[model samples]
Target: MVQDTRELNRTAVLTELLRIRPASRKQLAAASGISAATVTRAVEQLIAQDLVVEAAELVSVQRGRRAVLLDVVADRSLVVGVDLGASNTRVMLADMVGSPIERREIATPIEADATALADWLASVIDEIAGERRDRVESVYIGLPGAVGRDGSTISNAPNLPQLEEPGFLDSVRARSGRPVRADNDANLALLGEQHFGAARNAPTAVMVTIGAGLGAGLSIDGRILRGSHGVIGEFGQLPAGPLGTRLELMVTGPGIMRLASEAGVHLDSPADLFTPDASEPVRSLRAHFDQALLIVLTAATVSCEPEVIVLGGGIAKSLARDLARYEAMLEHHLGAAPRLTASELGDFAGATGAVVAALHEVYRGLGVDERAFGDLPVAVPASA
Candidate 1:
């Protein structure tokens, strides 16, 4: 038990140093709320582990003890984050301090060739981490479907069925040699917003991603609200158009084109379908899209009462053009609505969030309290 307590103190101090950075034992104690003697003992253990190091010193010209500053050994601590979209796969290498070191994106392989995809992903992971590969403690992967709560199985990914194939995920894990983690891509995007983008500090937030498909990710009370069965925030099935048609049928990027095609407009791109001087058919399609979006937005508003709703993915720019108008419409119906906003991380939110989750996992292994992250909305002194 004494050893356990000592380990816990080390985790708190190390976590605080990673966050505030290059701080003295005094500062770590103050920021992390750990006792000064405990912080000192923790620092000693961390330095012995080579996870923490002393760099530079703070001192006055007068006769006084110099304060040696401590920081995480960034190069010695690394993680990988992968955003596996149906069209593109993005990977990032992040240091323990949450700074992204490198990123690479490539066309995602077709669903028929799971082995090929895993091979390419492993090579990319190898290329990005290179000499730093050994330092990577965890690898995070985000997929565009419902990931089980335990993250061992993927039950609802229609586009990338290969992901659920026997031995496919295990192949990536075996090749990478690091523990691989997975979650819904939409959930990772929401995680990105809370950590480093639009939804930062929002107590409750909802994110709607409109790409090849429509998806939602929700955060309540600063915790990712993955539902009981790992099936939550499935916003695409919301009622839209007539009583039967789902919102995803008219609100996704492909769905938008379908709407214009059904209207006989024959538009080449979704952006073209929403011009100010659009033909009547195009206008009608846009109206249908608007109504569909409003339905999803209103549902998010009423159900979660999010502090903010962040729009993301390929179609977010198109939605942002008339965000205020949509906000007004939602207010008219619901009597109140949270602020509507666009994702600040844009296309990289999922990958970035994947890395953040990986870092959190690493911290937990170091004996840091999970509640420290749960209190991210109020407790952590840094952006994290």
Candidate 2:
């Protein structure tokens, strides 16, 4: 109806066509409610920018008239995914299709603050870009905290002490010089799974991350559910155990160790929980994990009734041998069992999730490209 509305509709058409199926001018016009002339003009602009290209010539069977197939040029754009944790930070460079080209992981020293961490992440991305930095579209970071409505970290995360300071998002953005998207790691993980892993076709699902901390990410009708406060599926510190033990501290490595030690057994490491002798500490750890998983499944099912439950994070892999145990526990609580599977991405899930989120944002035109950083201080020495 209006000029701006027409432009917006054109972009929406391009995005929807690229998302569903690559189509020609006629198809674009039919799908987008725009005129065929408008579709051709918009498609020409996109092709000039190398964002879309003619894939193949299709001919109708009736008259055999050739029609060129238009498809998104996926490699023309790229995004950087950053996963920041209390102990580590990882960076991944990926194409618009969410396929990674390069990845790097580095340990975050014991007490590094947010500023220092963002600097390191930016440097890693710069190095990854090298000379082809102009093509990178955006940077997305996944962290273990609630992302506030205004893109700041809420005061809920005690683990990230540096985030307590005011203006966290602005500080990170200023240093990185790239638009940054910060989301809960679990939310990103669920997205990564849906886009690239076990839940590809699942309409509704839940991804449970069992690690140093417990968290859940939810997807409903194929879209991630970020609650009003952006704390949709934060499962940490919830009363998860029979005696009201905090869920996160009870399901993690430290949690298992604590529970075992309190049961008068010594579990020096997570590996020790799998002893052949069936030690009391090992048994106690198993029981605690089972109970915690039951609570998690119960809560998750009652809320989302997901088609599948994906187990992700460090602890999930470690507990692979005891998957049956966890499932049995879940069954005891919730009569019918949902399909459960372990994450295939392993330690890379968060980083991969970040990449997926970044690509989605790029396609939606919601974030700035990394190479679009005009004149910020080259945080990393270029000559390195």
Candidate 3:
């Protein structure tokens, strides 16, 4: 019991350091609500473990002596984040403080074979890590599908069918030679927003990713909601207008292309539909998109009452110039729309969120209760 209490105090101090590093022992004690003597002992143990280091001293104005500031030795450990997309795979390495150190992107495997994908991922991990690959303590993978509750299997991934293969996660773990975790892409995107993007400090937020497909990431009180089957925000599968049962057929990039063709506007690609020189028929498709988006946003707002709804993915990113129109349409439908903003993280949102998830696992392994630390005040770099 005594050892447990001491470890708890140490974790408290360490968590505080992560939040506001380079803090004096006095500040850590005050921020953690632990007694000064306990803070001193915990700080000494952390320093001895090489997890914490003393930085420049802060001269006390009231007292003659200077106080040494403590900070986490971020370079001592690292985590890897991987985003397995329909077309590409992105891998990144980040330090314990969540700062990305390196990143790599490659074409996804052509074959829908688990072994092939694992080999490709392992190659990417090696390429990113270069010499420090072994420094990676854990790995988190974001997939564009419903991850099983155990984070070992993926289902309902039409774009990347290889993930459905049995023992896929095990194969990746064996090849990568590290602990591996997997989650739905949209869910991780929302977590990325919470930890390092626009939704920072937001208690509740929803991210609607509209691209070749449509999906959402819902968070309430800073916790992501993954349903029993790990498929909570598969909004694209929801029924909509006479077109089809899937809402993606109406609002996504491919949906826009289909709608444009039906309207007698033949475009080479869905991206062309957003060009300024788009035909009248293609321009008119915006109304359909507006209605479709309103439907999704309304459902999200009514159900979760999120503080903010973030629009992401290729289609939504292109519509940033027309945000006013989208907002007006949403207001007209819902009477009052939640705060809406475009995703600032672009395509890297899922990857960054995967890093955050890996960091959480690292914290747990170190006996740090992340919940007790509240939100950290780390400034996310404008360019990641």
- TM for every model, in the order presented, reads 0.92, 0.82, 0.94
TM-score for candidate 3, please give it: 0.94
Model 2 misplacement above 4 A: 2-9, 20-41, 55-68, 275-277, 366-384
Error of 3 at 140 (Å): 0.6
* Candidate 1 lDDT tens digits, 279-384: 8878878787888889899888887899999999888777777889999999999899799999988888898888888888887777667876743312121232
Candidate 2 vs candidate 3: which has greater lDDT? 3
Model 1 lDDT, full chain set: 0.81
1 or 3, greater by TM-score: 3
The segments of candidate 3 whose C-alpha lies over 4 angstroms from its true place after superposition are 57-60, 373-382
Residue lDDT tens for model 3, 95-148: 888878887777787575778888878778777877887788988998888887
> What do the candidate models score in CA lDDT, each in turn?
0.81, 0.71, 0.81
| Among all candidates shown, the one with the greatest TM-score | 3
